[model samples]
Target: MAESRPNTEVDLNSWLPITASRKAKWWYSAFHCVTAMVGAGVLGLPLVLARLGWIPGIVAIAVAWLVTWYTVWLLIQLHESESGKRFDRFTELGQHAFGEYLGFWMVMPQQLIVQVGSDIVYMVTGGKSLQKSLALITPQADFRKTYYILMFAAIQLVLSQSPNFNSLKIVSLLAAVMSISYSFIATGASLWKGFGEHHVVHYGFRSTSTVKIVFDIFSSLGVLAFAFAGHSVALEIQATIPSSLGNPSKKPMAKGVTVAYLIVALCYFPVAISGFWAFGNLVEDDVLLSLEHPNWLISAANFMVFIHVIGSYQVFGMPIFDKIESTLVTKWHCTPGRPLRLVARSAYVVFTAFMAILLPFFGGLLGFFGGLAFASTSYIMPCAVWLKTQKPKPWSFHWILCWISMLIGITIMTLAPIGGAHEIIVSWKSYKLFQ
Candidate 1:
């Protein structure tokens, strides 16, 4: 007779299951995703729209939302399908899904690049907003953008030292609401200028391209891809959702993601369309730059952009800080949330701000990070992990879909960065070091 064994109930679902004390409400999850995805993208949309024109740019936005949201769902699927092990961070998920080497080499580096790049963008953006705002009062002040970046860096260093993820929810929520506020303000400005002032609403239909049309299309698509980069923290946010000993359907996470993405798309397309209508071929890197002066709306929107980026920087920086704190505590015998950790994180923010001052090639870096990191972290790896974890049959519908998505990601990674690099090169000629 077979040996009798004790009965044990096992969980085949719910990776990163939330304990009762640690559980969060659904709105926090929604706000966190919104804060992660919306920054820097809105400011850069007019140029992206101009590059791809109205038709393709709008299509790219829609397609990117579909692809990004689908990959996020794949991650959710993978998390739900797992039984024993759990993933609470991006690198952890990558290490589990792929080999350890790929996680350390490819996934970790790309994510770090993306995160650091985000910090740089915030510095550049906040500096520009400060410069433009200060010009209103001190029109003769000759300080360079670097001073403004340093100024903003001081603010970010303070914000970055928030104790933990829970501490950032209100800031993240404010950042999300700030994005909505300024998106409407900027969109309204565009509409008012296009219809109210100019009385000429122009639309682009792929009429202008400095490079080859194909290159422009993919490059613009990269910008759209970058706009939806909340996937980096999807697992982190999901972990905050309230799960129980028995309840493990992932419904809260799913609902939160759906609401968050819907909110993103609603803010994204209207601004893109209205900005394109207002500026035509004259759209600047930031749509706000295209808005004429003597307008308080332009000033208000720019100030809002600066204020929002201040909070949003903390959202992106928290995950990086968590990683660093964990390493210091686990390996280096440093205390968490103590002086050493605070100094290290403050230095990290200053380093990113310094790099932005030195390079200030904001638009190009946006494209590059979009093509390189966003494609992989946001789509390819998630789909790959979903396939590996689920182990669907070869050539099955799910398998075919995953392959197509992976191919698309690879294509974006390969082609779009070239455009980004060329853009940086072109912009470099006009730039000087430290002012």
Candidate 2:
């Protein structure tokens, strides 16, 4: 007779342990995926739409959602194939697909870079919200940098000291609540004020050419693809749940991820569409800026933004620290005591602080991150791994579609220029002078 496989049952506790039921796992996966999608992506949509136009913007968002779903499917498939373990580390899947050495070198740095880039974006946005809030009390004070550092440090401390995954679940729940409340408040206020009536002027779409439309669609698609790229979190949760309760097959995890992404798209797309419709050409880089109106509404929005940012930092930071700890302790055989923990904490603080200082140079930062970092890791690398490792199933058409979407996403992101208003105005001036 074949030997029985070892049971992987874990004990549950309030302190640092990893026991979670199917219900807990579902909620955890849902919250993490939702939070990641909402962070910087929602805020950036209005500006993208204003430049690209309404039709292209809508198409981009829709296509991007499909791409995100497909990419996630590929990731989960890889996980299931290699380890036969649902919740293995992403790097392990890479290692199984590629060689161990190539996997370690490629996956580690890419994961770190993506996480760090995301944290920096959150820190900057959170700091901006705090600065705006403080300005209400001390109108002339400049606390942007100060608040950024403080928020970063606080997030680091919270993530580092958290006893277990349950705390993260609580944080995720709070984030969901804040996100729902903020979305409702912003939409309600916009409708009540007759937001469309105040639109000053409108600019016609710049390009009727097929090439221009394609380019616009591609650019917007990059943002949308990233908005739904956190399905790995769901995979992790699925791994922890009892296989007997649900199908041992990975279909539930994939289905859950699909539902979560659809929910996010529903919440985010309407807000994005409405913001662009109301503000037209005057839409700011951050849509939250466009939502600023009525003193009470502004305050409420600011507070919501602040909480959402904090929640984002906590969620992202925890996973990052967990990965770092695992690599150092298990892979490197380093003792993971107070000293190592402190070192990790200090590193996080310093990195976030530097990024906060560099936020004023947003164009350069976003360019480096979106073009080189995010595209390579989130879009290109995941697809490459899946294509190399997994056996094709009957429904493999979905996989082919995902790969194509990712290629389109990468091309679009690479071509989209970095600078915002200043760049646009300068380019227009140069063209006028030449004309």
Candidate 3:
């Protein structure tokens, strides 16, 4: 039988397959959200701090946290509304609040871009982390690009091929643990490198843009936004929370979200502040890359971070896989759990791997897409959706808050891309293609 098309206004609880197993509890829910929020993006927070100074960098991280937290709440609020019909997918919510045509156009493609783009980030980040770890024994294996290519193959071979997104609960939890472990390691190592070893110039509470880029402030700001964002998968992950324990009552999800981002702030701030203090204007795009030689602790930390990104890659990619698999099954009448689906997904992984190796300016491209693409889907759309779906009275406080969020989203959406684009251009000029 053909899979029934998703109905946004229908009782998603009755139909969505996610509710069947109830794979996630509150802590697991927090794990997935934290892993999603703090993946490859966190690698760049130190660099953001380097540009914005300690005070400003800390402020930016806080503001991003509050905004993202609220936006997530908005998404959750809108997801549960429409008189008890809940939505599990962002595209579904888009379809529900806005016209179906505009809604699909707004949500789906942005997700696809983010999904594919994030895989690229993982390949690069994971590859770099793997390379750093391996470099401990054999210091001469210095080609960064080679490691990225190797890690792509490694992930396909080692990581479990999940049957569906829900099955990735274990992966998400492990990924979260790995992330926390490494954050502490990285933070401690950075502070030590800065204070103990004296390997870098210190700039306490000062900001500087090391790279000459258009909209330099916005560019650095984009990196911070990317670091805190996980909204794309928020609803999908939330759907797995048992309905009885979720919104309209218990709001275990709300508790989970709060705890998750608190973990993020705790983990992120130390790394950002410590890293900038360590490297100052000399900080590289990835703080791990800035680690000086013969540091066993940092090397082990890198390995742990490397292992973590493997799971993070799957967490971000599975939703994309689900969407694509649905389309293939729906449009082409392809059966699920079959060779064709596997082949299609395998092909996508390869494509993303190549793209990551091709454009290795880790900070630039991701910042651009993160700010432009994710900023809206995560930030802009939630506010816009609430304003439209809730039908609030004109000029009310709620109305103003929604408008303010939209404005902030619009500014970020517009400026961050310019900064990201500039980063790409400058990086392209600096690095020889295929060198």
Candidate 4:
């Protein structure tokens, strides 16, 4: 199943985004994973937990962590599945697993959706967090979230032009730090609120109706699924690591991912449990929104969220940029240079910002996009490719595990989006665009 690469006078790999650099260390993958996984979605965990109650919510988060960790490892191994060839892109690996045409079609669409959808969500998260931070600082100063969204997009317009993954080192590093910082602040603040005498927290299901509760639980899974999303960029991240027969990229990649998952554990559990314990069913869709007291600290946390998502947007958007620019050069015969990068990247930023301005429903967007594509690319697609490529014995451990993971992912894929769409529709009834 090893597809031979064509001989070319010019090495196009140097021009492609993912393969442009090979000097990355194991730590790069660690923070990139953290920056990718612990994003705007973490802010929503309290709400997710609130919806599902204590036991189910905690169980859901734990299970998602284990499942995604396993699936991501499968993808990392599959990165160099073929001898002397590295599948830098998810579609490339998909092509290796299935065939050229079918794999491209299957993995590309889902991966694109995950990338573009994530950028859109980051736009909304960045803008809303900015707006909230400013509101806290200057309580009397009122402005539309659209304005902040534009402001946020302006920063991306510049950052998005970065030539390759290596260029994002500082941005990604800061984002990873901010993620940890705000998670700590959020968890500590929640504990503070929970212990305050004036506040009474009731731990119970947010919804009373069985039907509503069921849908909310499904939607909650999507939110949690959204929280654990870093799989889309796993191979691309690995591509940056220098690899050879004696020292495969997976060694360092696995080391990085292990540390990254530990970071995920630290950030996710405390924030989710403490926030839910602090606010119970009354938690806002974003935990930061729920913690309004101590204006300075909360404002700082929001600002940190703003800064963090700025990097998160690019992390997700880079692959999409690579896809678009590569296609333009290879298929359309466009020159690969600064002019192309400027035009392609700028258009993408504008597009995501425009969509974000139109639909800023953060929770609904997470659920919809998470289930619609995140679950596929982050959860299901890896396992699917594993089963196809490895062809494990029927009912054997690996085979059973892959099937079980797929079933869980399929359940999320099918149900979460329905709940998300429903949430969007509910929000849309009273919503207007660009206000």
* 1 or 4, greater by lDDT: 4
User: Which prediction has the highest TM-score against the true structure?
Assistant: 4
Query: Tens digits of per-residue lDDT for model 2 on 1-435?
Result: 222222222321111123233344555666766776675666667656766678877777776676666677667555565334553556666687788999877776766665676677677667666666556545677644555556655766656566334566777677766776676666565565444465564644434667655544444444554454464343444444445423553565566667667777766777677767666656665666666566567666766777786777666665566666555655675554556656875688567856565443332334344444555555666677776765456348756765686676567456643332233343345342211
Encode model 1's per-residue lDDT on 177-204: one tens digit a residue: 8888888987888887877754654454
Name the weakest run of 10 consecutive residues (lDDT summed) in model 1: 11-20
TM-score of 4: 0.97
Candidate 4, 142: how far from true, in Å? 0.8
Error of 4 at 208 (Å): 3.2
TM-score of each: 0.89, 0.79, 0.89, 0.97
Error of 4 at 269 (Å): 0.4
lDDT of 4 by residue, 253-349 (tens): 9999999999999999999999999999989988999888899999999999999999999889889988997787778877777888889999999
Off by over 4 Å in 3: 1-20, 157-160, 197-214, 244-250
Ranking by TM-score: 4, 3, 1, 2
lDDT of 2 at 280: 68
**Weakest lDDT window of 10 consecutive positions for candidate 2:** 8-17
The number of residue pairs in model 4 that clash at the backbone is 0
lDDT of each: 0.74, 0.59, 0.74, 0.90
